[model samples]
Target: MHDHDREALAMFIDYQRAQNLAATTIANRRSILTTFARTTGTLVDCDPFTLRRYIGRDARITAGTRRTERGALTAFYTFLHDEGLRADNPALKLPVIRVPKGKPRPFTAEQIDTLLASGAYTRTRAMILLGYYQGFRVSSIAAVHGHDIDLVSQRIRTVVKGRKEVWFPLHPMIAELAATMPNDGYWFPARGGRAGHILPSSVTNLITRAKKRAEIAERKLTPHSLRHAFATDLLEEGVDIRVVQELLAHEHLSTTQIYTQVSEQRKDAGIRTLAARDIPTSSGRGAASIAA
Candidate 1:
């Protein structure tokens, strides 16, 4: 029984290949199946008990992790059923776990001012501003060439996430930074000439080091956090969530909806503003007392 189960797992990998699953997906399936095999004892003698035990053990892991395992098991058993072996997917019985809600954390306005003030080089300053204001992913930022920026138009055409091309209009500050930078070099230059597109790690490290130098704590500052700040700032400014979604190049509207949840403090402020207008003056207070 164990050997038969092992054979079933191997056959499933082949089926995944035939379906043209992405390499990453293929790797994950292999990992999950391998975990199942190990947890089940010898595959040749395995039974449904082994499957249940594996899931039960992983129930102690986080909901997100268990969900991943559940998905992999479902796929595995589906393959087995198609191959005329197992008739049911035991992993389907796994309970779903809810992921906690989290807001996009952005840098304070003061921190942004300080970071830009610290970077001496015009090019470095522009790169930081671009990351903060335009929300370019590191790859998109690195892809920026002297030619891609249209100063006359005050816009940059960035290749984002392979399939998407996002053109971000430069804010006045960003435009000024770009204007000061040399138009001949990679916006953030690397060595080895053309092949030396700026590495994301290099900029991430630069920001991390700069934050440390500026005495900013590790509580919230990060390179990607700047992008989140960019989007959130726009939302806070009353920009439509749909427009922000386009600016951020989010594929799903739900991804953009997360930022719409304002902080509790802000909500309280809004309520206070409304309440202030309805407060009675002295004469109105007397009229209300007489009516009561």
Candidate 2:
């Protein structure tokens, strides 16, 4: 990479760190910017065509990954333009890649029962229950500490993005289990005296093992699937979509609306209702029959 580009990349990384972006995000941006510098030699030379070659139809990465790379480059060039380092942002003109949206596959009730009964330890069971009942992201589940649970009030507190702390009513089963845990540290403490709760990856691993033990055939079942089950179950039961949105802590109602798609059981019930309705059969004497 040219000296000017290297210097610009370093300055941009420093700016990102100052903005308090997550380490993983900063690392990804750094890697993408470095590659752009190496490939194109300078920011002044970067244009829409150059970016297209890196992320467009000819790119080897998945569409989703390409989108991420495009986003990173867009941010970088925007920064350069705002700082007066570049005259224009070429990344802005890159065509947007539309990745197909896949419907969420939630765990069946029977599958959830089997998973719970598959010999998960106490802490793991509590984690699974929280995700299944509360619709918590795995990161939020892992961050839960003992103090976050209020056995007396049957509530649990969690922090979401932007450090927004919210309290949710705890399920009775989860509250009862929380009461049995150590009160001074993490509800799901890290193994071997680590200072914080178990990592999100640990929760994921626990679910994977439990799924295998239960012989679940759904290959897509993961910690997040439990969350999907939580949302879909509420929707299937005819709960208001807005209520589900709040329960799932979704920022937008549109996000929750996806769950409104009828489940198989609900679909069957709807079809049955239609079948129960009576209608006169069409016949050659239909008009005469009506007159009679």
Candidate 3:
């Protein structure tokens, strides 16, 4: 990158920091911007067409990643234009990125019961409970401190994704787990970790091990599945999506709505009428004759 581009990148990073964006968000923005500068020449020089072609150049990148790249580019160009460094925001003119809609992979009801009833309170169990029962992110689960547990108020405080500090109602199950931890520092401590707590990935690995211990079939089940289950099961029980959104601390209702996709069970139930009804065949036979 030229000196001017480097200076602009630094300025944009500082702007993200001042906006109180999450560290990872800032880092990703910086990375995307720096990568563009290194691989594609000057950042501002690329028009919308060039930028679009560049982002689409790699077929291996998933649609979600492409969307993220588009967002990062848009933000950067907007920053440059607003700062009077660029005449126009080319990235802003980029077309919308379309991502395929996939149903949320919430644990099945039987699986949830099996997990909840699995005996003993290990850190992994606690982490799973925090996500399922408390609707916490993996990072929040790892960041839980002894002091965050206010037994009197029946609430626990933690910083969630996006650096949003919020308190969750201390689910009785979580309280039981918290009671076993030291009443200071990180509840899930890692001595070598810079944050003095377990890495989020480490927490995820623990969940994976516990899933196996629970005798679950090893597949694509992720730690976030518990969070999905938390949202899904509640909605299945007729809890309002808005309430689920609040419980999940989601910034947008649209995000929360992703979990509202029709489940296979519901879809099956809906289509049963089609199965039950008999349609006459060309031979004027009803469904029973066709089965023969």
Q: What is the C-alpha lDDT of each candidate?
A: 0.71, 0.81, 0.82
Tens digits of per-residue lDDT for model 2, 1-292: 8778778888888998898776557888888778776766656458888888777645567777888888999888898899999989888898888976647779888998988899988777878888998888887888888788887888889976555789988988777777787676777777886777787788889888888989987786788999999999988877888888888888988778777774777878877885455666776597888889
User: Positional deviation of 187 in candidate 2, in angstroms?
Assistant: 2.5
Model 1 TM-score (2 dp): 0.63
Q: Write the per-residue lDDT of candidate 3 for residues 1-292, one digit (tens) a residue.
A: 8888888889989999999998778888888888988888877667788798878987898888889999999998999899999898898778888899866888776876676566635676677778899888787888888889999999989886778788878889888887788798888888564668887888888777777767778485678899888998888888999988888998989999988785777777768866555765576567658789
TM-score of 3: 0.78
Per-residue lDDT of model 1, residues 60-179, tens digit only: 576566667768877876666666676665555555656676577777778878877775355556667778878986666665777767889988788665355677786777666666
Q: What are the RMSDs of all candidates, in order?
A: 6.4, 4.1, 5.6
Flag the better candidate by lDDT, 2 or 3. Answer: 3
Off by over 4 Å in 1: 1-97, 119-123, 182-185, 192-194, 276-292
Judging by TM-score against the true structure, name the best candidate. Answer: 2
What's the lDDT for candidate 1?
0.71
Q: Give the total clashing residue pairs for model 3.
A: 0
Residue 125 lDDT, candidate 1, scale 0-100:
62
